[model samples]
Target: MHPETHLALHHTRATDLRAEAAAHRLAAQARRPYAIRTRLGWTLVEVGLRLASPRPAFAH
Candidate 1:
């Protein structure tokens, strides 16, 4: 293949890959709130469980 043609093809492929990556990033961003909410809910549940458990006695 000619050098110019190869460079053009490479550029096109790079652009396409960048666009695909951008799309994936956007999709993850869209789900960011849900992910955060899920993590917060789990953390609260953990805290609640800890609070409900009995404490150990300390030795004098």
Candidate 2:
């Protein structure tokens, strides 16, 4: 491989690694209070809506 191409690939991989790390850290920090709560709230709303409305029958 050409030196420049190799260097470019290396830089791209490094950037991707950093981005993945940042995403993981943010997810971990938010998992407890942010993501979990938001997901649970949505789930509750969905269940409530399902309970309030009957599902439509599908034609075979």
Candidate 3:
């Protein structure tokens, strides 16, 4: 009886772990496309800021 109970508990824990891993993988997949867009947005903002800022004069 005790061994059966242990087996049941181990199965439950293994299922939970697998579910957690699947959730993480799904979340990462969802984020991957947005990640590239986010990086591109930030790059555009940085370029705009650099273009707007004045350049320093060089001495002869």
Candidate 4:
């Protein structure tokens, strides 16, 4: 009912949300290398396919 109480509640909730976000960010950071590797692997596979495929010959 009091303004101070409402402010405190908001502050506490904000702190909790920030902490939760930090935890998620850390987890994502930990897995970042794996994500990058997966992307790179897919890119390499795509490049390989492109290289292996026959190209259209240009007529003069």
Give the winner by TM-score: 4
Which stretches in model 2 have alpha-carbon errors above 4 Å?
32-60
Model 1 C-alpha lDDT per residue in residues 1-60, reported as the tens digit of each score: 999999999999999999999999999999889988999999999999999999999999
lDDT tens digits, residues 1-60, model 4?
A: 899999999999999999999999999999888988999999999999999999999999
Candidate 1, residue 48: lDDT: 100
What are the TM-scores, per candidate, against the unseen true structure? 0.75, 0.51, 0.70, 0.76
Q: Write the candidate numbers in order of decreasing TM-score.
A: 4, 1, 3, 2
Candidate 3: tens digits of C-alpha lDDT, residues 1-60 = 699999999999999999999999999998898898999999999999999999999999
Which portions of model 3 show Cα errors greater than 4 Å?
A: 1-7
Error (Å) of candidate 4 at residue 1 is 1.9
C-alpha RMSD of candidate 4:
1.7
lDDT of each structure?
Answer: 0.98, 0.94, 0.97, 0.97
Clash counts for the predictions, in order: 0, 0, 0, 0
Error of 1 at 21 (Å): 1.3
**Per-residue C-alpha lDDT of model 2 across residues 1-60, encoded as one tens digit per residue:** 999999999999999999999999988987777777899999999999999998899999
**Alpha-carbon deviation at 55 in model 2, angstroms:** 58
Q: Which of candidates 2 and 4 is the stronger one according to lDDT?
A: 4
- lDDT at 49 for candidate 3? 98
The deviation in Å at residue 28 for candidate 1 is 1.2
